[model samples]
Target: MRVNKLTIAALAVVAGLSLTACQNDDTAGTGRSDSSSSSKGSHSGGSAQDTAKDSAGNDSGEGQDTAAGTGSAKNGATGKCRTDELEVTAQDGTIGGDEDNTVAVTFTNGGGRDCSIAGFAGVDLKTNAGTVSAERSGEPAPATVLKDGESVSFSVSYPANDTGGSGVRVTGLVVTPPNETKSVTLDWPGAASLPVTDGSGTPVRVGPIGSAGQGS
Candidate 1:
């Protein structure tokens, strides 16, 4: 009876040890599963954060470009003048036959901004034999910045030749702005005839554009 009792007690101890070992193994497997889940969640969060940073960086670069474009347009100090923003006219300023026969050509800035009308302006006499060329002056001067509604006048003068009915008769004149290709045709109000040679070889004389009226 004592040996039987001892054997049964030893079997109970072994069974208890096997149960505890199984429980420890299960706990270790559960811990591994939980760690894997946490690692996947961390990776997903890092990917989302990287995407957001890239988007914000692109938006910031685009905003800077837009601001630069706006600033350049607002400050037009070094901008060149356009032909569509000007108002041109011509009139006869001739006094008598002995004096210099002059024609006043005026240019006015019609826009709300300031611009420059410097350099030599090209002139053309619109005649039936196409257009006649004009000579540009060689004098150098500073450029005048014309404000809104400000005007500048330039004169085209020539020596009077009161011969017979032999001089050319030009009905109008075409004036070209400096560094511009477009031309404006204005009426001529001088006299019966202009004492300029035809388009054979001589070119009409032109002066520099001067300030007119009272706007600085």
Candidate 2:
């Protein structure tokens, strides 16, 4: 009976130790699972943050590119003067015989914004006989900026015919501003006329566009 009691006690002790060991192993496994989950969550959060940062960087770059393209388009649209924005006029500069006959043609910016002009203007002398296109003078054409309500002028020169019989009857003048395609017509300065040619048979000439009051 004593041996049996001792054996029973030993078996109880062994079973308790085994149960405690199983509990410890389960708790350790649960702890390891929780740690792994936390590590995975941390890695996922880092990846999300990195993705957000990359997306923001890409968005910023695209924004800059879009702004640059818009600026370029705006400049291309508004940098040059349009034909409808200008008011053209012509005045006789020097119309006489035996001299260089010149007409002062002015262009006023009637638009609400500033614009630029460069190069020579296209000029045509309209006569009862036919239309005569003017040649460009040998002068440098500097780019000029005209503010709203500002003006620029150019000169149209032709050879004078001392013999009045050889002159053409000028009725009107067709003027086109620099870098423009549309044209404006103005009645020839009162009672003015142009000769078909001087003794040298020189063609009508148009000077470059210049500042106001400084006819080119």
Candidate 3:
């Protein structure tokens, strides 16, 4: 009976050891699974955060660009005077054979804002025929003031010897308004010897500025 009891006790001990081994293995597997799940979740969260940051940065950059463009356009339109719509027309007027023949030029100010036409010397006039001419009357010594929707007419004097006839070929004209620079091209008859009708409807009545025989 004692041998039988000892054998049963050893068997119980072995069974308990086996159950403990199985429990330890199960615990290790559960720990590994939990660790893997935690790692995956952490990596996914990090990637999501990075994507959100990138999206936010891109949106901010676009907003800044749009704002800058708007501001630049507004300032350019309001704070500056350009050659936008400013024009000069030359008409053949009778100068009566003076050494310097006077030509009628109509100056039109076509801007949204008022600007000073100061700096007469600042304004430059060039003829396509290589004649160097200067502004004659209404020249504001240094500049003149021209308001929007206003027009001024003045005479630009040129030497009769400098130009063959009233057919003046305008090349370039620049007016330096206060805080603004304006320039335009004169492609029409700058000097004329005959009354020619302008198809452009500027009514430039071209005629002999000095000698009417010169052809343009």
Best by lDDT: 2
- Per-residue lDDT, model 1, residue 168, is 67
Q: For candidate 1, give the lDDT.
A: 0.75
- lDDT of candidate 3? 0.52
State in Å the error of residue 27, model 2.
Answer: 66
- Give the range of the ten consecutive residues with the poorest summed lDDT in model 1: 207-216
Cα lDDT tens digits for candidate 2, 76-187: 6447878899988888777334257677888889989899988988888788878888888878889889899999888887765556674787878998887788999998
Candidate order, lDDT descending: 2, 1, 3
How would you encode candidate 1's per-residue C-alpha lDDT over 45-155 as one tens digit per residue?
999999999999999999999999989887756455667888998887776543557777888899778888787678887655456676755555458788889988877
lDDT of 3 by residue, 1-216 (tens): 999999999999999999999999999999999999999999999999999999999999999999999888776523433456456665654456554444554556787666554323223455554434343333224334567877555544443434344554556544333344555445333443322223343222222112122211
Which window of ten consecutive residues has the lowest lDDT sum in model 3? 207-216
Name the better of 1 and 3 by TM-score. 1
Q: Considering TM-score, which of the candidate structures 1 and 2 is the better prediction for this target?
A: 1
Please rank every candidate by TM-score, starting with the best: 1, 2, 3
Which pairs clash inside model 2? none
Shift of residue 29 alpha carbon in model 3, Å: 7.8
Runs in model 1 lying further than 4 Å from the true structure:
1-67, 73-78, 97-99, 196-200, 211-216
